[model samples]
Target: MKHKSLAIPYVGWMALFVVAPLILVVVYAFTTREGGFTLDNFSNMVQYAGVFGRSFLLAFLATLVCILLGYPLALLLAREQSRLRGMAMLLIMLPMWMNFLLRTYSWVFLLERNGFFNTLLETVGLPKLDIIGTPAAVVLGMVYNFLPFMVLPIFSVIEKIDPRVIEAAQDLGANSAQVFRRVIFPLSLPGVLSGVTMVFIPSVSTFVISRLLGGGMNLLLGDLIEMQFLGSAYNPHLGSAISLVMMVIVLVSMGLMNRFGEGEGEAVLL
Candidate 1:
């Protein structure tokens, strides 16, 4: 009875915030301003398919980059001694301690035409790179912001692995490459999947990064949805429709990750 009672507050919180908001989104998505049922909002979403595609593409690239960079770094961190590991983890998390918006905006100054990198290039007589207000900038921003999400989960998984397993593999005549390929890589799938989900979902749905870094030239699914509700359009119904579609995509992605990660155990999101 006590345990059951303890869940009451959490259930109530979910009902009030999560469930209620979802229900409202559904209602807004499927109903007309006059309160009549309709499907026009969803049907209209097809017109913005290109924006959705671009969002997914950018997110995919960013997640791939993070994995490529983070996997090796996670391995190094996982193998570090306790004190060194703690310091490395702190450095990885340092950027996250700042306001998300502030961190994103800082990139603007670094990548702008007259920004630090460009100035350095000019000083060195190298051609200046025009990266700000471009898709490359959006991808860079996403990777910078979300790379830790990829590293931490994989690091946690790798660190938790029993050292005995590696010794056993070596005793059985397995080489370093074979041990990693057959054991470490397979065992780490859950963490990799979790990191992919963590990075991909937010990257796909981000509007602020695209808006600020891409100078509004890159229109993602998130930007489209925001425009419907908060931009000149002011159409909540369409916005809700887009939100529902995004939710479906995210759920599908999570389902795929869960399927692949089965038998490896659940991945720690943090």
Candidate 2:
């Protein structure tokens, strides 16, 4: 009872910071220009559906990229023992130690017209690709930043798996590919869902990646929200509406993952 009482302050802090902000968003989503509660904010989201659609598409692609890059890295890390896994974790997380903006700006430095990547292509007599200020750059930034998030959860799931399960399958005449297909892959679904969720929500809401890396275009809902909040439009109500739409999408996505992605053997890969 005493320990529970001591933990009340921590719980209160969580409510103040996390719960309060979320409640505010929900409340503001229903607020009107006349400062009355209404569904107009949500209705206003119809005007910006194009932007939200594009943002979800971008986030989905970015999460896919993270899965492609992170899954193998996670598998490699999972194969390692205690000390080696710790070292690999540190290496994977080293980039995250830097500020997110700084890391994103580093991509700007690398993807600029005359950046090192282009310079190297020039030296090799290859055509320099234009990537910055495009959706590609936004995807790059999202993948780079969220890859660690993808890896950690998948690695956790992969590492927790019993090695004997795979060995048992092999003894039953299963090959490496079969062992993975029937055994290891299913066990890793929870982690995959977790990684995708982690990557998608932030990538969808990140104006910075689009602004700094995507060269400030009409490629995402985040940019639209920023314009609504800070630009000439300056309708907090509409911005809140758009934010609420995003929140719904995120919630639905998470719910789907939770419902279908809880068990490894339950993944229905079409």
Clashes of each: 0, 1
Please provide, for model 2 over 64-178, each residue's C-alpha lDDT reduced to its tens digit, 9 standing for 90 to 100. 9999999998988898777988888889989989999999999999999999799999999999979989988889899999899899989988989999999999999999999
Range of the 10 consecutive residues with the lowest summed lDDT in candidate 1: 261-270
The regions of model 2 sitting more than 4 angstroms off are 81-87, 262-270
CA displacement after TM-score superposition, residue 84 of candidate 2 (Å): 6.3
Off-target runs (Cα >4 Å) in candidate 1 are 268-270
| TM-score of model number 1 | 0.96
Worst ten-residue run, lDDT, model 2?
A: 261-270
lDDT of 1: 0.91
Q: Write the per-residue lDDT of candidate 1 for residues 1-270, one digit (tens) a residue.
A: 657988989999999999999999999999988889999999988898998889999999999999999999998898887798888899999999999999999999999999989999999999998999999999999999999999999998888989999999999999999999998888888889888988998999999999999999999988988998889788899899999998998787777667767755455352
